[model samples]
Target chain A: MPTADHATGSYPRTARTTPTRAAQRASWDRERVHGILDDGYLCHLGFVRDGAAVVLPTLYARVGERLYVHGSTGSYPLRTASGAPQGLPVCVTVTHVDGLVLARSAFHHSVNYRSVVVHGTARQVTDPAEKAAALDAIVDQAIPGRSADCRPANGKEAAATAVLAIELTEVSAKFRTGGPNDEPEDRELPHWSGVLPVSVSTGAPVAAPDLAAGVALPSYLTAQRSTNA
Target chain B: MPTADHATGSYPRTARTTPTRAAQRASWDRERVHGILDDGYLCHLGFVRDGAAVVLPTLYARVGERLYVHGSTGSYPLRTASGAPQGLPVCVTVTHVDGLVLARSAFHHSVNYRSVVVHGTARQVTDPAEKAAALDAIVDQAIPGRSADCRPANGKEAAATAVLAIELTEVSAKFRTGGPNDEPEDRELPHWSGVLPVSVSTGAPVAAPDLAAGVALPSYLTAQRSTNA
Candidate 1:
């Protein structure tokens, strides 16, 4: 494996971004990081709140190398980050569980997953234009082309929402892809050994109870369900 | 809709655990919390490291009111936690995305998810009996009855692993279900509105290249795929 770069083309391998163990599973590739990030809309956003760590599952979208997280204006992270002079230090993590690796030995059991961890100072998006775009990006992330189909946010609606932006300057993508890597001696054990593949699948769309009569299911949504994560 | 319990039948909600907004979506019911935690094995664990917040995706299991997290003995959280006299303060979060709500208005779009957030001081489990049991619970959480089917860890493998236990003292479960909750005025808009139900589905098991010929796929593995996550 090539050494992580400080961004000729990859993210900077800052001290905290480097892995101390299982270095083979970690990558700083820009495109790989984006693919993992783009595959999901929800992220576990972590921030130190009142001297203790807090992790919240929230919506997020990627625009180039920056991430915009959607939250309520009253949410703790949004409120706190807006008040900080230098922005609140935060970590945003996205994960897609690909499979369950059940080995002959319990010690080697694991999940094959693709995950990206981003460390940065989260600054609230205060500019109106940027905030609007961020919200659109978040909506589109969940259902591609969704933003164009829905009504744009009015002033009061936009006021109630919050967006926090974090750059992908210090980030790393770590993943495990193959079958169970059981030890040589354990390979001959009788227990079943293999990868039980798992993935997010969209079921038939359930229309809202109060949806207008003439509205039809969108084509983009139909397309989204056709692909597996 | 009830006040959070400090722990008669529910985990007490501290100031931090209490919801500052969307109070209706938060709950301290012990059973509800357990159901959310048991739905997934992968969790985003957050801890303060070197004056900055770091979040890592890891495996965790619930046993009664306690959580046992598995990691390499040399992993940062395990190593740092063992050195702490009073135990390391950490937060564990689990989320299961149920659906994607596409409202008539972009501002109202959201995800249907069940999430549990646990805040506690993590202590390294040093007792041999407790450690072994925790490992069993961890494996069983992933696949019920799996721990009994596989070879138990040998001394060297067990020594290389670490189990960090955290009591479910301060906890909260927040969730959103049902279809899009669009504004009344927006309900008649031209946009289609509904929830794209999503779920984790397991695929056919792929046997390891060196898997023994006689070992049959476990009954539980097949059953797991038949149910919706």
Candidate 2:
């Protein structure tokens, strides 16, 4: 299991849990957490602006122990954090809904999902090497063989992208799996009840017509077709 | 097309569009907006708490002209809005990623996604009739025939649910669809480039073992198995 170490530095309120206890609701073993993160390609990032909360959907990737998020350099929140003292206080979350739990009663009806929330101040990654690695992680996160098959960014292209790294040290994962739990009285209710299983698998890859004729599908690319991970 | 009537109330800044937009950035049509909302099941709702921002995932349904969300009566955020002067200001968003855009150059890479963001204050639905409709909408949103296949909630069950309704008067939709767009110069780079299409569909429904032996599958339930919507 990979753990995020926080000895580098301290962030504001990073260690203090929110009063709602939403930040510390449940503890997750490392494999469960990483598996969820690896299966997800996008995340919903939340932050405060002018005293009101705003949620934005963005692409993200997880490396050894940190998550990398990037966006257009012109986006407000990312640009604002570039020079702010506290950086940008954010609650980053990634979720994967695995199945739908259909309980006998409405109150117990829920979805089986695995979610991870990280509370921290995301800092801009300035080092060129780290920035390159982050970009590769993002590509690989979307498709396993993609990063190596594509051309690396040139100087001008690299300068246009803004990358931020959030260490996943103070993170927590929550999951709800398995079938529904119905009250004993409702068991005799005539309605049918059970779990609706959900999963995602890749179909046969469609190669671009413009592709140079002889370039065959690589092993890494073919591996994704059978992967449910 | 269902157009959002701004005449009912002034649109908030987030949902309001400026008049001087260029042609390329002006794709705010009603059908495009509703299509995005209808295609998604989960929404990310953002709200402010003691000057910090919080985002939570919740189930959502779109009624004829309104968006509905419901949760337990004990949920703090939903309960706190019952007495707030302007109701709780919220940012609700739904997104669906269609494919991965693998640009030849890293900087141009992006995901093909359809997203809708609603900016408004959500009011608690107090009318019993309205609440019942909202609950039905939610069930139908999850599984199209679910509401009719099961017995309707009784008086006690209905009373236990708390529903909130927000008119879709101020909404904005943004989308990035289609294949990867790589720079002209990078087109000749040795790379595998094209869309790896993504989709979600229902799998075989696992019938409860307790179901009466030899009971035929309901037609409505059977229809859902092949539906992508």
Winner by TM-score = 1
* Best of the candidates, DockQ: 1
Give the worst 10-residue stretch by lDDT in candidate 2 chain B: B17-26
| Global lDDT of model 2 | 0.68
Interface RMSD of the candidates, in order: 0.8, 2.7
Q: In DockQ, how does model 1 score against the reference complex?
A: 0.85
Colliding residue pairs in candidate 2 = none
**Candidate 1 accuracy as TM-score:** 0.96
Candidate 1, residue B4: lDDT = 38
Measured against the true structure, the TM-scores of the candidates, in listed sequence, are 0.96, 0.87
Q: Model 1 off-target regions past 4 Å? A: A1-7, A224-229, B1-7, B224-229
What fraction of the true Cα-Cα contacts (under 8 Å, chains A to B) does candidate 1 also have? 0.90
**What's model 1's lDDT at B86?**
93
User: Poorest 10 consecutive residues of model 2 chain A by lDDT?
Assistant: A8-17
lDDT per residue for candidate 2 within B70-178, as digits (tens), equals 6655565678677775788877878776666666666666776777777678888878888877887887787666676565667877776777777776676667766
For all the predictions, what are the DockQ values?
Answer: 0.85, 0.47
